[model samples]
Target: MKHNFGAGPCILPKEVFQEASQAVLDFNNTGLSILEISHRSKEFEEVVVETERLVRELLNVPQNYSVLFLQGGASQQFAMVPLNLLPEGGKAAYFDTGVWATKAAKEAKKIGQVEIVASSSDKNYNYIPKGFEIPADSAYFHYTSNNTIYGTEVFEKPTTSVPTVVDMSSDILSRVIDITDYDLIYAGAQKNMGPAGVTLVIIKDEILGRSGRSLPSILDYEPHIKAGSMYNTPPVYSIYVSMLNLRWLKAKGGISVIEQENIVKARTLYDEIERNPFFKGTAAVEDRSRMNVTFVMENSDLEAEFLALSKERNLIGIKGHRSVGGFRASIYNALSITSINALVDAMREFEEKHK
Candidate 1:
């Protein structure tokens, strides 16, 4: 069995990849590859339409909300979000969690005043910052739902009187969430969706039109939403594969079922880490992520041997971010229970041998 633990452009359901590969070669038996199909064609339109429908159906998004599949990863949305929502000189509340959150805040700074309502940097981002007040006059309150590089997560989102915009790049569909809780949610498709190249944006109707700035055709959200994510030539293959993934998720009883599975998977690995003598977890227990399980050995001496053994066992991408040195096993949506179990087993086996 092969287990992939890479962070982005990570593992997808083998079935989804297989079906997508077929489409790339011969879409709908139309004798055309998805890559070459015109975005205006009915074939591609169906793909976009189905993707939108599946997104709303899977997440129970309200009618007033619009979903757009666009180019530029979540990073671009970071800038677009502040530009679209912030009034002239208006401010926004930002929570600094990790790399992505910092990027979002940095972009927001360019548009208007930014208040660091909360931050976890003091603790090296091993814990979530809590108990910050959102400025009532702020245009929107933005936070990163999960910190991918640091293995930290804000499980219970902070409440704000203003509109809430979330960068859900790493943990968008990993669980069930009420769409009404946020005005805008942006997720890069690479992590839990399909591939890199596209970003998913869900925006509420009310919060738009505040920017007032003249946005380039590509930077504006309304244009893409109006064109049904086909405003310009889209990444058809990525969106098509994401549709298949959403379909796979719907078949498995939607987000509720997967949320439970994610909990079990995370707990199984975290429990082993907590119990093992040579292992120590990095993220605070209360703020640990359900998708990325990060930990470190008692000493760094055995790192080479551990990685080599894991690779030998067909496990991949267990290395942590360079900024935070340790082991990070990314248990994304496509990662199976059996795979997590194998990682746990390997940990135990390694501990027994090393101890």
Candidate 2:
């Protein structure tokens, strides 16, 4: 069997793929593929509702928050957040740890002032920045929870009096997070949630309507909340698949249980990287991401050989991002511990052959 470790639109449970395939063939015994169903249909409406409900239940989100399935993915959220939350002449604080975080901060700058309170750019984002102060007057403190490309993650949320907004595209549902800690949390479904085309936004209802600027109807959160994420033809197939994945998550015990498995998977791979002399982890030890474990060979020349060896073993997507030339094994929530073990075994075998 092939082990997939791609970054986004990454691995999912085999059972989820099987169920999603069946739905694509025939959904709910309706004799209609999910791809053809209308978003307004009762069947599709139930999928959207259940998907949102599962999100709330899995995260233990308080009633004060509204869960929205939106279009345009998390990248759009970078802009919508500033348009809807950053008031006129207001400034927002951001932690720039990697590429995605920098992109988010840049988007916020277009709407208003953005203060990059901390950054790890000096070290090529091998670690998460710390000791940054969030401005009290800032509209919101934005941070990406996990830096996918750099393989670094902020284990603890930044403590700040200002509203906190997290772009959790890479780490959402991977572990347990206190939903009440932030004013907003948004993630692209392609990561731990589901396929591409759907973005999940969890916003505290009171935070809306505070932005003084006029937002386009599509960018505004109020209308989407009022319509229950059904405004302007939601990504029907994506939401359905998300619902199936959420069901799978619920069945495998909730986030808390899944988190333990993820911890084990990450440790197995990281331990291999640490003990194997042929490789060195890229990120700082403490800040290394549990979702994406990036590493480089001691001699860069060995990179291609190691990749070829891994491919021969049916291991794939271990290559890192292009900007950062190395290997990145993305062990998302759906990725099994067995797959990680296989990768670890492959690494050990390759090392033995070389050493």
Candidate 3:
């Protein structure tokens, strides 16, 4: 079996895939494919409810918070957040760490003023900036918790009193986080939660309608919350599969258990990268992500050959993003430690050949 390490549309538990695939033919004995069923039907509604409950329970989300499964991914959220939070002419503070963070600030600028507190772009986003200042008068502060392309992550929520929003698209649910730490959190479901079509949003209820700008019903979070994520036809299949994956995660002892595994997986791979003479990591040691591990070779010319060998060994998606131009191994919740080992072994093989 090939090890999958692609950035998004992530790997899911085998059991989740089996159950999701079965639902495509027949969902929970409804005699109807999940795709064919009316989203308003009780069966699908139960799926949404359970999915939300699982999310709340796993994250220990506060009762005052609203959990929603919506469409258009975190990219959509980039606009929705500023539209719903930043009032007319108000400024928002944003911390820029990578591409998504920059894009988020850019979108917010189109809606209102944005103050970039700090940026790591000077070093091609290889590290997280420190000692940044968020304006106390700003409407809210926003940041991307994880940078997938650069393989850097912000583990601790930056110290700020203002309302905080985080785009945790790539690293949500992989580790344990206190739900009350932020005013709003949005993650694209494709990375660790489920699939591409749905985006999971957890928002503090009081933050709604703060913008005072009349928004399109679909673009507004209030309407979606009022409709119970059924404002329009939701991403039925994506939500259902996410529910299944959540169930699998729960059965595997939830986020805490998976987090330990993730730590070990990341350490194993990083250990190989450090031990191998030919390899070197790109991200700062302190900010290196536990989800996506980015590394490069001492001799950049050997990248193509190493990628070819990785494929021969049944490894997939180890190639890094064009911007980074190195190998990025994305180790999501469902990716087994075994897969990490396979990649490490391949690195050793390359070292043997070169040494």
Poorest stretch of ten by lDDT in candidate 3? 128-137
lDDT of 1: 0.89
lDDT of predicted model 3:
0.94
Compared with the true structure, all predictions reach lDDT values of 0.89, 0.92, 0.94
Runs in model 2 deviating more than 4 A are none
In the range 1-355, model 2's lDDT, one tens digit per residue, is: 9999999898888998999999989999999999898888888888888998999999999999999999999899999999999898889999999899999999988889999999989999999877778989999999999999999999999889999999999999989999999999999999899999999999999999998877789999999999999778888888888999999999999999999998999998999999999999999999989999999999999999989989998888999898778899999998888889889998899888988
TM-score of 3: 0.99
The candidates, ranked best first by lDDT, are 3, 2, 1
Report the number of the highest-lDDT candidate: 3
List, residue by residue over 114-173, the lDDT tens digit for candidate 3: 999999999999999987788899999999999999999999888999999999999999
Report the C-alpha lDDT of model 1 over 1-355, residue by residue, as the tens digit: 7899888779998889898889888999999998898888998889899999999998999999999998889889988998888877888889899888999999989988899988888888999988888989888999999998889988897977889999998999999899999999999999998888889999998888888888888988889878888789898888999999999999989999989999999999999999988788999989999988888888888877788888988889999888788789999998999999888888888998987
Query: What shift in Å separates residue 27 of candidate 2 from its native position after superposition?
Result: 0.7
Candidate 2 clashes: the total is 0
Q: What CA RMSD would candidate 1 show?
A: 0.9
Instruction: Give Cα distance to truth, residue 225, candidate 1, Å.
Output: 1.7
Error of 1 at 86 (Å): 1.1
TM-score of each: 0.98, 0.99, 0.99
